[model samples]
Target: MPTSRSSSSIWTYLFLLGEPEQQQRFFKELHFISIVTLSFGVASWLVTVALMQHRHALDTQSASLALVGMVAGVTITALGKSLLAIVVSGSASVLFVTYGFQVLIAATDDPSFWVLPLGVLITLTIAPLFSGIAWYLAVSLCVWVMLGWEQFPAHPQQADQYWPMLAVVVSMLIGLSLNVYFLVLRIHNYQAQRELATMAYTDSLTGLNNRRRFTQSARQLHRSALAPAYFLMIDIDDFKQINDEHGHDVGDEVLRKTAEVIAGIAGEHLCGRLGGEEFAVIYQGDKHGACLLATQLIETVEAAFAGERKVSISIGVAELVKGTDLAHSYRRADASLYLAKKNGKNRYELAAS
Candidate 1:
């Protein structure tokens, strides 16, 4: 049966295009950005105070507002409120923009000109989505306001007028370039991590879930399933003899064929290659349904390899109930599989209730 889509899964696809683990990593990166923003604010404030020794505290009200925003960002992040942290971070970027503009309006060559571009860069790379868009409008407003006023030095020399304007354009371009670099770097890192995770959880030979992934998936399925779940442990009959007679290449082909059969029959069910001629499935069904599936798998394998050497499978079924240990259930299924092998090797056996 098709299961309902989960809210978490939807969020994963929409926001990060990755797993829960990647989302957690994103939150951590956000927290780091918050810290770095706060640190930058502190450093810039110190530079402003040292450079303008004659300016009173009342003259630097924008600096005070930026300080408040930085503190709030730090506190909210410490509380583990990621959404609130993002909001505060965006607000801080806005505050920094106002503060930096004030400083530049006062002294154009005070080494504080970098502050405005820094604020713009923060909003572009790390701020909330809507806030990032709002920042572009804010910047356009600033440019319009500057065009009407004489913020630049009133000198006869043409260099005086054009040099400051050229600096502003270059600074903005640098910020935009940095934003693109950061975005590409983050995407590459995420893709690398996802690939590493896939390698860890998959069986390279058969393209099936390895033992570790199977165990994790089975336990999760056991917890969520509303109906009784059955663990089906399957093993190829006389697998070693086939390897001896037909060579390891044929053995590999047999393993691949078996995996294909299981995948075809299972169809969205939790199944995996549990190492070396053995496979398992966590089937959501009763004993009768489980028996029917086992019988079908046995006959399908036989028919698939009929032209060559005969191929057969033995399956062991064990019911999994709520509040029971999954490891114990697996052991019960394995024991029954051993019994099936002892009782003539080409049939299934059910574990005692």
Candidate 2:
């Protein structure tokens, strides 16, 4: 008889046999639909063998041989097919192994007839091994069927002898239904998680990184030992007055249009919404390049908003110096922006080291 540990191990193996995510990915990534189809065919063969042995008045030796053939067929099917194929094939294999053990016990009266049932009972008791809970239940149901059939009296044409077979079929249907339901739930959860992550890191209004994501990237840049980087703080001049004069909707449109201009000027740079009417840009460039970029941004915004509505911006550029953190650079850029606004709107300022 198998010990409790061995029985537990077998159950664990069966449980892990069906991982829906792995099965789906395997079929999709490797284009293994054909293998999956072939596995279904093999399952049909196992079913045929089981029905034949049950109906035929075969001797214990013949039943044992038939069971072995079924096991081999199922194993081959599992090995040749995809992950899902293995799950179904493994279920059939469990059934055949259980039947073979029973036949061997009946053939030899070596005080082991008791052991066979005990072993099967133990295997079923523990549940299927590492397979998903659904697959484990399915395989367990199949094993139970084999055990139940064996227990039936050997008399041919007994109506009660068919109960075990019916029970097995019912159990299999329940397992398959449960597996499909859980698989769908898992996929839905995965998609929801991905969407949530995207929303968390993205700005909904302007389709840029929000303040939170920008700060994270800034911190990452501070930790690196790359060449000097530039930090620019941009604020729309007289933004509140514009909202008061031209409805908030127009103000919102202005913000969106400004974001597009900033994004264009900060090509390949990290740009994000800092707050209302304020934005930030971080780029790896020298002081001169940073100033030129900032100038170009001011010019572009001025030209774009010219004649349609009066618009201007105040930009502050600061080169990230060695030993300076993101907070320090932001402070310097903010100070420069304040100076620019104070001096005049629609102008750019470069912070001194």
Candidate 3:
């Protein structure tokens, strides 16, 4: 079976690229760490090559030249660090194979003439199949080319040359795969959190903002310089009597139907269920708008409930004052609502100053 590594690699790439703002901090941290690690690898490789030359008493000029090339490569990578990390890590495998083949060629007289042909065939085959696979092939190919196939001596220790190349290829693949996996996991968690937040703020029964969300929205509106808005609290008249006379099931149906009637009349106004038998609306306009909406709501509910067990509702409207909070607005509306019930059931009242 093909490994989970490939699947994980795909997920990681998508996570990093998806929801730019949501994952921006993670991306930034990943970029910084990648750059630091890549720099260290390049530095260590150059140091190792220099030490080997010194120990073997080989020509210092060759080692010095190699060190310069390594430094230049490191500098190029650091300058465009993010892009280079992706490019290098993604293509590590292909580079290893390609440079490994060149080394093999240098060590043998008639290095398999098929090496180039086979490498090309493999590169072409994998590149179109999967991004990570294509990248691995490309990196391996680059590594083979860099190993200098022309200089591979006849009596070489095949194990030494091949093992280091294999190690580099494996390490790069592992790192890339792990990075992508964790990134995808983070994205999934973020989506779940967003869904939970939405549920918390929304009323499932009415499909409106619940009391909690209404308070939050009111605070937002209070900060704006818009026209004075109104808060209207409404309660079904003798709702407990309805539940007692008719079954609670009928009472629930009545409540649902009443919510629909109020929502239809409220139109663009924000409406929500504050609690049992009580609903609230926030209208972003003058008192006239609130009065019109209240009248419409009263008419709609009366019409809808005319023959359905003779139900009725009381409404109270309060205009938002400058420098007032949601609690105060709610209190005002509630006071008006109490007056409407006291004066007569099935009526509307505006809060008195």
**Per-residue accuracy of model 1 over 92-205 as CA lDDT, tens digit each:** 454553455455345444433443454444444342222222333344345424432443333437656666556556655655455445544655787898789889999988
- Model 3 misplaced regions, further than 4 Å: 1-184, 264-268, 304-309
Total clashing pairs for each candidate: 0, 16, 31
Select the stronger candidate by TM-score from 1 and 3. Answer: 1
Q: Write the per-residue lDDT of candidate 2 for residues 182-247, one digit (tens) a residue.
A: 444544665686689779988888888899999998888867838888899999999999999999
Which tens-of-lDDT digit does each residue in 266-346 have in candidate 3? 787778888788998888888787888888888888899777568788998988877877789789999999999999878
What does candidate 3 score on TM? 0.57
* Candidate 3 lowest-lDDT run of ten: 124-133
Deviation in angstroms for 40 in model 2?
Answer: 28
- Model 2 CA lDDT for position 309: 93
**TM-score, cand. 2 vs. native:** 0.57
TM-score of each: 0.72, 0.57, 0.57
Top TM-score prediction, candidate number: 1
Please state the error at residue 63 of candidate 1 in Å. 5.5
Clashing pairs in 1: none
